[model samples]
Target: MSVESGGGTQAVERAMSLLVCFTDEHSELRISELCARTGLVQSTVSRMVSSLDRQGFLEQDERTGLYRLGPMAVTLGSIALNSNPLYRASRQSAQNLSQTTGLGVNLAELRDDRLFYLANFEGAKSPKSFTMAGRTAPLHATGMGKAILAELGDDYVRDYFTKGLVDAYTPHTIVDAATMERALQEIRNRGYATEVEELAFGRACIAAPIRGRSGRVVAALSMSGPLSELGLQGRQEELALTVIETADEISVALGFTVTRAPARRTTTAPKETAR
Candidate 1:
């Protein structure tokens, strides 16, 4: 490459590397931390961060002298989701599912080995609800996360589990890798995933994968509720079917052709029983 080309490539690399320094664990960082993580000179890091800040990609805290992702990044991400046909098609279906099931409905996508909630609808009868939009949840412990993982295959699942430490958010949280793998396998075999008080006590959820035109799973649609209602044996099955059918309808609306044959696993096999 020419000198100018090499300089431009290096600058792009440095900018991206700096952006990667922010993580869930360290959502905010100081200039010294950025310099250490990116291995760039303090002056260069300062200049680059200032440029990013001006573009609204980063925001510096006046009180703490720390930097975090800015509102511009959130605005851009929201724009991308709103512009997607899948998101647009799924909105009404999600609302319908929430209304029909009397449970909170959530739409999410797998990113960075976690489920990122994109949209949510609250049920009419839900007493207490948790809002998860723009939040990330563990893959092994959430119905939406597990549904996405089931579609991504084993290698991706392994890499994901290896990167993060599993925590027992509730007594029912599956923290063992082998057991979690078995759960994912069952989710793949069947067509839906379930979480019974895995993420939080007394909360349960069922989710199904939302496929794209190429038959690749791009997102998940879930119905979540308190255990008192969804925990009943027959009620859970009814809710699971509702979630699956709703997701399928939304996928079709997004122009996803379901060309693959269904898996051989029994749809009646309760995921909660498997656990």
Candidate 2:
């Protein structure tokens, strides 16, 4: 590429990193905080922040001197979410599932080997303490993550382990390749994945893969709640079936045709059966 184009690309990347540093947990930050999060010098961050502020992508509080996402960012975020095919396909079904079951519904996609929550709908019975829409979670410790893992290639899975399973989030979180492999196999066999206090101490979730028109596991849908309320021991089968059906419905809406018979697979990649 030409030097001018390359320089422009790098600037764009730096700006994006700065924006990403402002997540749900860190909604506002000072220039120093942005520097710490992004490893960029103060001068660079300051320049970028000023440019972004001028463009309405960020705004600075005059009194507190902290920067936060501005009106343009909100407009762009809404447009992007509404235009996303997975979010569009899953939103209504996710809401309906949460309303019907009184269980929190989550839709997530695997990005950079981590599960990025696209939508989180809280049920009437769900705790209203936190929102997960802009959050990310480890692929080795959550139901939705494991469901997607079950559809990935074995070589990819092995390479993923080289990055180190994130430190265990709870006593039940899978921290070893051997154990996680077994869990993936179980998910493949049962057509779903489940996590009990693996990601959080008191939460549990059941998830199933959502396929695209090309028959690829592009994302996952899940239902989550407290362990005692979900009652895994008593209703595991019923809850699993419910999640699987809802995921399949979203898959169909995304243009994946249903097939009565599915092909057997020997590895972790998606099954080669017709959709």
Candidate 3:
């Protein structure tokens, strides 16, 4: 390879490595920490970080001198969401997940405690699977609905249950307010929700919530199959994670930003480090 091209590639790689170093656990970092994580010379790291800051890919806290992801990253993610590629890939992903697991996949939004499917992909072998793309499913009965409600907090959920608003689609449906409250808390903890024969006998599903740029639960993505196929009764943790990942991908493409604003700051320089 030409020396110039090799140097360009190396610079790109180094910049990307520095970007990935910031994670949920390490949202902000010091120059020394970046050098430690990337194994790049301190001076090289400093130079690249300044370039990234200039490009708006990273922002340094003026007071504390820590670096975190900047607004441009979120803007890029937002742009990707509006691009056709994400929509096409989102549909194909639904189809691929259905094909991979032999399950029906659905994309839905929560409306007044109900799940209204906007798109549906039925598994190859599960042609008979009912598609609710244009229909609504009860919140307490379906995985997607429950997943949405899980993010609405405890008070709203409690009101829903106490008002006798839950529909008992099956004997397994959770009608008790206390029980539903606990389940929602569990969903918050686990980052997903599951329903086994609650919506319909022998049909089970798992779902995850999708957030928008506002960081609110805007929709849900779900997977459904035979109770036996999903192993809902036996082992479905892997399936739950997969469904959550699917929703997360769509959320990212939909311009959902995970970064929080500065912890605390004034128009003047902050007195403390921005968390």
1 or 2, greater by lDDT: 2
Which candidate number would show the highest lDDT if scored against the true structure? Answer: 2
| lDDT of prediction 1 | 0.81
What's the CA error at residue 38 for candidate 3, in Å? Answer: 70
TM-score list, all predictions: 0.72, 0.85, 0.60
lDDT of each: 0.81, 0.85, 0.76
The ten-residue window of minimal lDDT in model 2 covers 266-275
Query: What is candidate 2's lDDT per residue for 60-148, written digit by digit as tens?
Result: 99899999999998798788889999999999999999999999999999998899988999987776677787578988888999889
Winner by lDDT between candidate 3 and candidate 1? 1
The order of the candidates by TM-score, greatest first, is 2, 1, 3
Clashes counted in candidate 1 amount to: 0
Q: How many residue pairs clash (N, CA or C atoms closer than 3 angstroms) in each of the candidate models, in the order given?
A: 0, 0, 0
**Cα RMSDs, all models:** 4.4, 5.3, 21.6
Residue 44, candidate 3: Cα error in Å is 80
User: In TM-score terms, which candidate is top?
Assistant: 2
Question: Model 1, poorest ten-residue lDDT window?
Answer: 264-273
